[model samples]
Target: TVIRDEVGLSLDKADKAVLGTAAKVVLTKDATTIVGDGSTQEAVNKRVAQIRNLIE
Candidate 1:
């Protein structure tokens, strides 16, 4: 489960179940990116389509 808020900061450390694993992560001052391991490709595709629909 991904914690989508600052409340996640309260945790000293999160377990793998709480924080999903990924191949790579890139963090910038304004953004954080996670490269998944393809296990959730279908979910990703669905989310991308949702975003595209919202954008259009």
Candidate 2:
């Protein structure tokens, strides 16, 4: 979907059903590569921001 692309996640498995039934948190490699960044938090935040942007 358009939202996925914005965050630079892989579209390799875009099918919603295949995406997983539980909550999805996508961690983009680019966000993780930021110097001195907290990888886990950065990933979670990026995913949350992406979803929030869609609804807002």
Candidate 3:
């Protein structure tokens, strides 16, 4: 998704530890909808945006 890619790009210059920490934050925030069976693609995209905003 666009938001995910943007976050990844923004974190490109981050050290591995920082990136990994960011990844954990992103995963934790998005985990529920991402792992839910009824979650739509749009829901996933919104979650990505939420995670991106948190990191940025």
Candidate 4:
């Protein structure tokens, strides 16, 4: 049971990593048009929303 649980957790972590990577990709593509000398909070929020939409 312990081994099975560990394997399950590992799989979950891998899945989450993939999803996070995908989210980052989505954010990168969408956030490129944003213009500013520095990173903007609005851009980050927009990117996060876009990523969430992609996941859904």
Candidate 5:
């Protein structure tokens, strides 16, 4: 269940099961920031490589 909103304050009411965990979260009218716990470093590196390949 992907929740889409300009600001994610609505997540306050969302069920815990559908919500994700992050080291920190900050939301504002213009942006949302999620700081991860770095457990997905390999996946992030792979995606970054894929993006670089695409841009090259």
Candidate 6:
């Protein structure tokens, strides 16, 4: 909870579990399909997507 006029950060365990499941589903897909042409932009975007899909 937030104190009066103050900001606080907290991690929700439930959200993490759900995101872990979603990442496993997304990252298991073929990288080639996600990044066609293998151009510079495609490669960069693919790498970023892979990083985001990581659970931790």
Whose lDDT is greatest here? 5
Tell me the spans in candidate 5 whose CA falls farther than 4 Å from its real position: 4-14, 37-56
lDDT of 3 by residue, 8-46 (tens): 655455565543322222245546322443457997689
After the best TM-score superposition of candidate 2, give how far the Cα of residue 23 lies from its true spot, in angstroms.
10
Task: List TM-scores for all candidates, in order.
Answer: 0.48, 0.33, 0.35, 0.33, 0.40, 0.28
Q: What lDDT would candidate 3 get against the real structure? A: 0.52
The CA lDDT at 45 in model 3 is 83
Cα RMSD (Å) per model?
Answer: 5.1, 11.6, 10.9, 13.3, 7.5, 11.7
Global Cα lDDT for candidate 6: 0.42
Relative to the true structure, candidate 3 reaches a TM of 0.35
Clash pairs (backbone) in predicted model 6: none
lDDT over C-alpha atoms for residue 17 of model 3: 50
lDDT of the candidates, in the order given? 0.67, 0.56, 0.52, 0.47, 0.68, 0.42
Task: Provide the global lDDT of candidate 1 against the true structure.
Answer: 0.67
Q: Write the per-residue lDDT of candidate 1 for residues 1-56, one digit (tens) a residue.
A: 33434544334466666666788999999977778656667888886787677559
Q: Single out the weakest 10-residue window by summed lDDT for candidate 1.
A: 1-10
**Candidate 6 minimal-lDDT segment of 10 residues:** 17-26
Model 5 pairs whose backbones collide: none
Candidate 1 C-alpha error for residue 51, in Å:
9.8
Writing each residue's lDDT as its tens digit, candidate 4 over 1-56 gives: 11135345544445543333222222364563324424369966886787687559
RMSD of 2: 11.6
- Can you write out model 5's per-residue Cα lDDT over 1-56, one digit (the tens) per residue? 34546446466667876675778999999977678846488976785687577559
Residue 24 error, candidate 6, Å:
32
User: For candidate 4, which ten residues in a row score worst on lDDT?
Assistant: 17-26
How many residue pairs clash per model? 0, 0, 0, 0, 0, 0
